[model samples]
Target: MIEVIRSALPTRCLYSHVVVSGQTIGAVTRIRYDGPGVMVPRVFGSVFFYQPSQKINLCYGEITESATVNQFAEVIAEDLDALRDLGSGVWADTVVNPVRHVVEVGIQEW
Candidate 1:
């Protein structure tokens, strides 16, 4: 089984973590900005991990300001330590995108 926890800054910023059983294996963070025109909602980050074989996958992307999608970019790590290192304060202004965006992170044992 997988458990997920999410937190957001008002409505523009979002952060989430995914845990398998009792171990944290994935996480996501995003920031959104207000623009003059109508923007399509999109996700810009992702995270995935497979414990059975110790496999990991991650991806990141950006969509046009007028485009929208059901999901967003994701990043994954091979282990808990790697995941923590990658997600460490990812929401920090020094690394996060300046534009409106969304991110998703997850981990699983299969």
Candidate 2:
């Protein structure tokens, strides 16, 4: 896993390590120190922007900064036991099997 925190005012960058496993392929949890930014009227905000030379710069990474490497590790440790039942390769398969009746019901609803 890989993570980074950048500050626009000080022009500083901080890097953190990420941990990955087969069981939690798409799990992403972020810890923010202060609350999220206010969403006022007529104000637009985004996470990234494009610059010249085909470069990309990110904006407002406070949420990612709140999670240190150790904190993330702790979260992983807490969930490790429950994850044991799911083998490394089990994540690759679909857990939700669809029956013809269910599919038909879903189609009717749509």
Candidate 3:
């Protein structure tokens, strides 16, 4: 997912703050879930958007399903341009099955 956002940009780097050349493109990932260290995707693949070295700190939130997040990658692939227009936020769906990518409180972004 981070690669998708990075590759879309000319700098090929993710930043928390926007630069003169590009907009801020960041991804909040689940670094430590109920999984082992061998999982390649969970491990930070790109240092362009590195998180804190600590994971045992207090978690602000928890995603119920790692599989459901795949839906986001699919959504971005289907319409990267549309996603570019879409602002930062979380999905509205209550189901863990993740059928769609509807943003929660989407209008608030505008």
Which candidate number maximizes lDDT? 1
- Which model is ahead, 1 or 2, in terms of lDDT? 1
The digit string of per-residue lDDT tens for model 3 on 1-110 reads 33343333332211122222122224333442332222222211111222342111111122222321111122223444444443122121212233444233111100
Ranking by TM-score: 3, 1, 2
Task: State every prediction's TM-score relative to the real structure.
Answer: 0.22, 0.19, 0.23
For each candidate, what is the lDDT? 0.32, 0.22, 0.26
lDDT of 1 by residue, 1-110 (tens): 11211233222223422222222223222322222322235333433333333222232333233323222223333453554454444424223343333644343333
Alpha-carbon deviation at 34 in model 2, angstroms: 16
Worst 10 residues of 2 by lDDT: 101-110
- Candidate 3 lDDT: 0.26
Q: Which stretches of candidate 3 lie over 4 Å from their true place?
A: 1-21, 29-49, 52-76, 87-110
Model 2, position 7: C-alpha lDDT score = 24
lDDT (10s digit) by residue, model 2, range 1-110:
11221222222222111123112222212322332222322101112211111111211112233211111112234444433333222232333432221111000100
